[model samples]
Target: MVDADQTFVIVGGGLAGAKAAETLRAEGFTGRVILICDERDHPYERPPLSKGYLLGKEERDSVFVHEPAWYTQAEIELHLGQVVVSIDRYAKSVRLGDGTLIEYDKLLLATGAEPRRLDVPGTDLAGVHHLRRLAHAERLRGVLTSLGRDNGHLVIAGAGWIGLEVAAAAREYGAEVTVVEPLPTPLHSVLGPELGQLFADLHREHGVRFHFGRKLTEILGQDGVVLAARTDDGEEHPAHAVLAAIGAAPRTALAEAAGLTIADRAHGAGIAVDASLRTSDPDIHAAGDVASTLHPLLGFPIRVEHWANALNGGPAAARAMLGQEVTYDRVPYFFSDQYDMGMEYSGWAPPGTYDEVVIRGDVGKRQFIAFWLAEGRVLAGMNVNVWDVTEPIQKLIRSRAQVGPEALSDPSVPLESLAG
Candidate 1:
């Protein structure tokens, strides 16, 4: 291993790569640090693109984590718009698209993920879109800004966060929105059937059409603009725009090419990583959506693509690179804003391990929180507008305190009291 102050090369410039660079400085390592981002622009917050940014409430600049000057001032090289084509792990160097190479003592493979595209026919149509990058958001924004209310229909292929949020936004813009999800419930994999049903109700109440347990057979379009969607059931729904947010896959091509261990942790499928966020090769560290590591609360290796991981995993990976034996363990926290409602979930549900569930507040009243219970303790939690309570629950979960199911289901009990 090289000295602690040696060069660090990060492959992705999203949340993980950006925060890792920031944390390196905080840890007092002032050596040559380089961040290689494929995007042309500086690292910006992606959460807002579906919510505040789409609602016209936030400026693009306002969402940037750090201005370009921060990297320059900190003496960290920011190589924007550069794609790292391959990594020579044996040589401890990374080669870029331009055939230039940069060597590093320790590397961070924060290559993030790529948006899954529609494989069906007519997917090449012009009016179709996917929301993953800044350019994508711009294209969708242009469509919403210039479209007809009666004739304009946005057909979303998935009911995940981006799909649902775009549905809300499209409706706000007076565009008819139809969400096509193969799953029986919108967020079934994450929120359970009950809560997922609530989400379906919330959107249905607002004129959004839901086609559950259905798959898009093909997108019929002309001249690069979407026309309608032909479903597996032989049903056709007219559409002016098609948004494919089926999910994302781990960008593991470069990692695999470099002889790094790659697994099934792509898109709906998860990857496998150790407790320290190290791939099969310890020299190459992974983070963000692309990584599959041991979940702190569940005590199991489960790969998740969450906002909290992108934010927290970087610091953990950095600590490991700095030789500070740290684990990427934390309650998996993620939130979504839908139709003026705040929905959040924390902790991890051990695979097929949610033996019981307890609830607080009123689910119908829209002020509820559900606690996932395994062996009568909180493993994960979901809340609807009960954020203040979510904080204490998060702490209790991190501390691994023994808060019983009785108190968890009672509304009179304060969340903090369960911490001890």
Candidate 2:
């Protein structure tokens, strides 16, 4: 069924699109592959943007998904720093910002997401930064270094993963960091109160100040430079720089303009797609953060924005496009490295979904595995400072087995055997 005459145009050159292009070639698809990116940089992983790269632990060139020569070697039409303005679905063509149009037999949207901007006053100031791109990270790295050198203050909004990671990085540079969060604790929505408090304590131990249960009301600045951040609680915190790590919204403008069905806010507000990653238009597929797929196991439309999803979802979409039987049922997985702690979380267990959180090992020592369960069934597992357990944890979730708390909390019990 493969033909050399056919062409596949993939919009967005993040990990998902790049991997999709790689999958097409690997799956023996002789069709022409074109990858488009709005950013000038090559496809790069984002974790390093906050973790290693921002901390100066990783090289600037280490973030790219593949070497620059690899795309050329694979014969992928790499269109860098070019924006696709419109998608004429009916004509099977996309119009770029430069007034160039390209026809395609199939189209893939991996547009990903953008950082939610701070809406308060003075957000447009010079010291206000958002971490979502390589360029943003590059600028933030310099900001952290300057803040550290001058013993300046950095005020961060939101206590989510990005905020916390950057807080750790700023502290590593000996910069004073203050986190203003609307929630009661860090990562409250995802990890619940118990684990959230643990993270709050962890950051506090590293000399990070947390103004919990407060939201940034406005940013105070002078001459287009940030001075301080005012919270809803009538407290103004002196800040040399401010990082808005509130969250990200899926980049769905292109898909929406193309008359594609977008998921509601409850389903991640992304481009709605089936398990096969097919959009409303059968010929148009989506993946990565932009695609909200109806999950087979979860029985709900879910969009995962983590690196693992992009790493796997793209290849799955490519296989589906190749007319292969595909089910993108991968359990949502994510990892975080903050300060001295390294953690991997597998499966979904949002606050309301899980009834009890059982912990194994020592919490004070910060070496533990926490399992979230609903009616004895393990919904999610987070291993902190633990290694080689993600496979077993995922198996436990996929098996949908009723695991006992006693066994789950026992270090002697093997997780793999429990799944069996």
Candidate 3:
């Protein structure tokens, strides 16, 4: 149990930060708990910013982590619109933007990530936007409503999850949408070629156009407002607005400046932490996207940027901060919704490492359970247009059981019965 007089300070204001605060109080941490957030609003979840919230199907208040009164009731002090400028390890204190110093016995870094800005010429134009925060989504919502479905055309650069989901939302708003990707297919690096093609087909069926294998050279604008995008091949795509959804880079500057170990160049830049989520400094812990943790299962350090990691990692880090023994071994998981198709994937293996993809259901009909296997052992699995099977899929990966491809592809075989 934590000492009653000790204080804990949590930096960052995303889901991971909020969850860490909740865990501290629930796990009997009676010490002083302070949550520092740079945003004007309280901690909030970001998934809805691109999906339901952007489409206006969900209310604005629903996205916040908790009602304003929850913090007061829990006795958690909140520092809103305050940036942490420096960390004094020797003094065990943090300096805020306004020149205030907060002392802490233990510190948690949950600084999430920021959207990658396109460096092209016209990206700074008035009509071009990147959706990373609630305010960005709100602006995009206004742009969509004003443009309407038939009145505006949206050119989305990049075909990642954010780009595709935003494309779907734009289509629902009755706007003509076109997506451009440098790769041959969308999500090629993560889902591989065949599964990537399935998503490509799904978008095409919904009247969305694709410009695959092309590089965006410039964004054309008129009077400081975006009007079109020009590719490297001299092709011009006209647009009333542009969404630069290339990707996000983990927010690691604060951790880096604090003298924490960062992952190597190959693994990407993330605050390096152990299985217990403790950084190089024993008193400091990192979680969520900012942490590149040594996975007990994968045998390597990986930084997962999905919602599940923050939802689960926050609690694990909190427990570790209190000197409790814990290991974060959950498989990386993420899902996507585009048009009528919903897909869930669990486990992680780099794209080219898996030898074969075994399909248990029909792929032609767009409903199937696909497994990524290497040397007859299940490494990862995905269920597309299928439901109620994630638990079984995760079991297959965690158990590390070897099964023949014939058995994996056979519909007569039950996923639960196959492992034993």
TM-score, one value per model: 0.94, 0.98, 0.97
lDDT pick, better of 2 and 3: 2
Candidate 2 lDDT, tens digit per residue, 1-420? 345599999999999999999999999888889999999999999999999999998999999999999988888999999999999999999999999999999999999999999989998899999999999999999999999999999999999999999999999998999999988999998999989999999999999999999999999999998899999988999999999999999999999999999999998999999999999999999999998999998999998999999999999999988899998999999999998899999999889999999999999999999999999999999999988999999999999999889999999998889986
Residue pairs with clashing backbones, model 1: 126-224, 126-225, 127-224, 127-225, 265-270, 265-271
Span of ten consecutive residues with least summed lDDT in model 3: 144-153
lDDT of 1 by residue, 232-253 (tens): 9999998888899998788877
The predicted structure with the larger TM-score, 1 or 3, is: 3
* Model 1 residue 288 lDDT score: 85
lDDT value, residue 321 of candidate 2 = 87
How far out, in Å, is residue 298 in model 2?
0.7
* CA displacement after TM-score superposition, residue 339 of candidate 1 (Å): 1.3
Candidate 2: stretches off by over 4 Å: 1-4
